[model samples]
Target: MEPLYQYAWLIPVFPLAGAMLVGLGLISFNRATNRLRQLLAVFIVSWLGASMVFSFAILWSQFHGHEPYQRTLEWAAAGNFHLMMGYTIDHLTALMLVVVTTVAFLVMIYTDGYMAHDPGYVRFYAYLSLFSSSMLGLVVSANLLQVYIFWELVGMCSYLLIGFWYDRKAAADACQKAFVTNRVGDFGLLLGMLGLYWATGTFDFDVMGANLETFVESGYLGAGMAAVFAVLVFLGPVAKSAQFPLHVWLPDAMEGPTPISALIHAATMVAAGVFLIARMYPVFEGIPVAMTVIAWTGAFTAFLGATIAITQNDIKKGLAYSTMSQLGYMVMAMGIGAYGAGLFHLMTHAYFKAMLFLCSGSVIHGMEAVVGHDPILAQDMRLMGGLRKFMPITSLTFLIGTLAICGIPPFAGFWSKDEILGSTFEVSPILWGIGWLTAGMTAFYMFRMYFSTFEGEFRGNEME
Candidate 1:
C-alpha cells in the first residue's frame, strides 16, 4: 500500500490514455454507433474512476500523516536555466486531486445521459477525459513552468469543449471569446512567471518560496518589483475565475453544452484561478497592497455577479452569473488572508454549483419534450414554472442545491461561507458588509430563480 503511492503518476495517465483511445477510435469510426459509444463511455468512465480512486488514496495517505513528496525527472537545461517534469504531492495537491477527479468523474457520468443523442457523444467524452487530465496535471505540477504548461492546456481544452458544436455560430463565437480573453491574462501570467524566476532564480514553486524572502531581505527583489509581479500573477486568476472586468467570457460560455458548463465553469476550470492563488500564497502574502487589491476585487466581483444574476432569465446564464458570484466569494476569502476559508468555499461551491448546473440541465432536458429542443426556448425561465410536479426529483435536488448556495444552515456551504464572513469581519467590516449584502441577494435571486422555475403556474403553452 505504501509503495502504491509511488505509482501515483498513473492517476493522470489513465484518463490521458482513455482520451487517446477515444481519439484513435474516432479516426476509425467517426460516427460510432450507439452501442459502441456506450462502451467507449463506459471505458472512459472506468479509467477516470480509477484516477478518482488513486486521488482518494493519495489524499487518504496524506490525512494519515504521510509527508509531502516530490518527484522530478530532468527534462531540459541551458545556461542558468532548467525545466524539470514531475509532480509534487502535498496537502493542497491531495485536496485538489480529489476535487478535480471527483467532480470530473461525476460529470463524465452525467455526460453519458446529457449527450446520449448528440452526434458528438464519443468526442465529448474524449474532450472531457483530456480536460480532466489537464487539470490533474496542473494540480500536481512540480514547478511554475509545469503549472503554466498545464494551465494553457486547460485553456485549450476549454476552447475545444466550449465550442464543441462548432457549426453553431454562438458556440464558435463563445469559444473564440473565451480563448482571446484568456490569452490576455495568459500573457500577464507569462510575464509574472518570468518575473518570479528572475526574482527567485528558479521556477520551482518550493524553491521560489525558499528564495523569495531571502531575495527580498537582500534587496535583490524590491518592493515595487514584487508588487508588479504579484498583480501580473493575479491577472491569470482574475480572468480564469471570471472576476469582474475580465468576467464577460464566462456567462457567454453557456453556449456550450450543459455538462461543459457543469464541469468547466461550475466546478473545475473556473476554480483553477482560486486554486492557483492558493498555491502561490507565499508570493502574494509578501505584498500587503496586493492583498488589499485581492480582497476588494473579490468583494466587488461578488456583489456585481449577484446583481446581474437577478436580471437574468436564461437558466444557465443566471447560474453562470451565480457561479461568478460564488467564485467572487472565494476570491474575497483569499484576499482577506483566509486561505482555508477561501478553499473551503471552493470545495463546497464545486459540489453545489455543479449540482445547480446539472439541475438546470435536467430542467432543459425535460423542457425539450415540450419545446422541441429549441435551445433558447428550452432554457428560458420565463417558460418554466410549476415543474416540481413534472420533475419532482430534479426539483427536490435543485432545492437542496439552492439552500446550500444561499448559505442556509446545515448545508455544506453554510459552514464554509460563515467562516469566510467571520474572517472578513475580523479584517474589514466594510468588505464584510458587502459580502453580507451579497449573501442576501444570493438568497433572493436563487429563490427567485427557483420560484420562477419550479413554482407558480406553468408558463409555457399547453403541452401537445
Candidate 2:
C-alpha cells in the first residue's frame, strides 16, 4: 500500500467537523435565522466539497488495485482478540469513496436551492454533512465491527434527515419507521459479527478470509453454522436495502425533503446494504444457502417493487419504489456470483437515480411556488401535467434518468442491467427471465409517471 492510502481515514473528518460546527451543540441554529443558516451552509459546502476533492486525490493516487491495507487505532483487546477504529482501503473502497463523496457533494449543492426557505435549513446541512461522514466511513471500514458502527451512524443520519421536518406528523412517523425497521436488520448483523468472533476470534475482513479453514476444519463452526452466520449478516442488507416484505417504509420516506430523498435512496442509506454484501462476498461465497436465498429474494423484490410502482401517483413515492426495485437487481447479481456486475449497476444507479430524485425535487420546488406551497398537492401527479412546457430542462433531464433506469438502449442502465442479466442467464435462466420482466415493468411504470406528470393537460384545479 502506498503512503497516500493512509489518508483514506481522513475523508470523513471534514464532514463530521462541519456537522459539529453547523449544529454548534445539537440545537437549532439560533432558531431559523437565515444568516446563521447561510453561514452554516458555507461551512458545510466548503468542508464537504473539500472532502470530495481529497477523496478524489486518494482515488487518483491509489487507482491501481493494491493489496488490502489498514490504519488503526486500537480500541480494545482481550489478549489475542482485538478491536480498533480504522479504515480498510482496497480497490473496491477506492471506487466507492469516489462514488459516495461525489454524490454527497452534489446533494449538498442541490440542497442550497431546495432547502433555502425551510426553517431547519441549517440543521439539514448539518445532518447532510454527518451523513456523508458516516457513509464514507462505512465504505472503508476494516472489519464487521467497524461496519456495524458506521452502519448505525448512517442509519441515524437517515433518521434525522428523514424527519428533518419534525413538525409534520408524516415526517416524524417515517423517521421512526425507517429507524425501527432497520433495527431489525441491524440486530441480525450484530449477531453475525458475534458469531464470527466466536468462531475465529477476529473482526478484520482480511483476517477472516485467511482463516475460513480454521473456522470450518478446526471444529469451531460447522458448515450449517457458517451458513447461518452468512444469512444473519445478509438480513441487514435486506432490511436496509428495503427488500421485499421489509420494504414498506421506503415510500413513506417521501415525507422528508426531496434532496434528502436522493441522499437516502440513491447515494447513502440503501446503497450501504449492497456495498456491505460486496465487501463481504469472499465470506458469503462459502455458504451456498446464503447465496441462493439472496438471489431469489432479490429477484422477487425487484419484480414486486416494479409492480407496485405501476400504481403509485405520488412522484417521489414512485421513484422510491423504483430505487427499491433497482437495489434488488444489484443484490440479485451479487447472489448469482456476478460481483462486477452488481457493483457496476450500483455505481451507475447512484448517478442516474440521484439525478431522477433531484429532478423530482426541482419539479416540486417549482410547483410549490406556483401552487401556494402545499407539497402534498404539488407532488401528486394527478394534479400535475404539461410541466415540460414550463420546466423544460428538468423535464428533459428527468426523462433521461427515467430512460436510464428503464434499461433503454444507449443509456447507463442498459449496459449494467444487461451485464446482470447476462450473468444471471449463466447461473439460472429462470431468474434471468424474472429480471427481464421486471425491466419491462420498470419502463412501463416510469413512463406512466412521466406522461401523467408532464405530457397531458394540467389535471390540477384552477388556482389562478
Question: What local distance difference test score does each model get?
Answer: 0.90, 0.87
TM-scores, one per candidate: 0.97, 0.96
Per-model tally of clashing residue pairs: 0, 0
Q: Candidate 2 residues 16-71, lDDT tens each? A: 88888667644644655456677768888898888788777776756654566778
Clashing pairs in 2: none
- lDDT (Cα) of model 2: 0.87
Q: Model 1 TM-score?
A: 0.97
Q: Give the residue spans of candidate 2 off by over 4 A.
A: 1-3, 25-34, 65-67, 217-220, 462-464
The TM-score that candidate 2 achieves is: 0.96
| Residues 1-464 of candidate 1: C-alpha lDDT, one tens digit per residue | 56756788888899999999989879877765334999999999999999999999999999999988888998998986777899888899999999988999888889989999998898999999999999988898888899999999999999999999999999999999999999888899999989988888888765686687678778877878888888899999999999978999998899999999999875568988999999988888877877988999899999999999999999999999999998999999998899999999999999998999999999999998888878899999998999999999999999999999999999999999999999999999999999999999999999999999999999888644
Runs in model 1 deviating more than 4 A are 31-35, 462-464
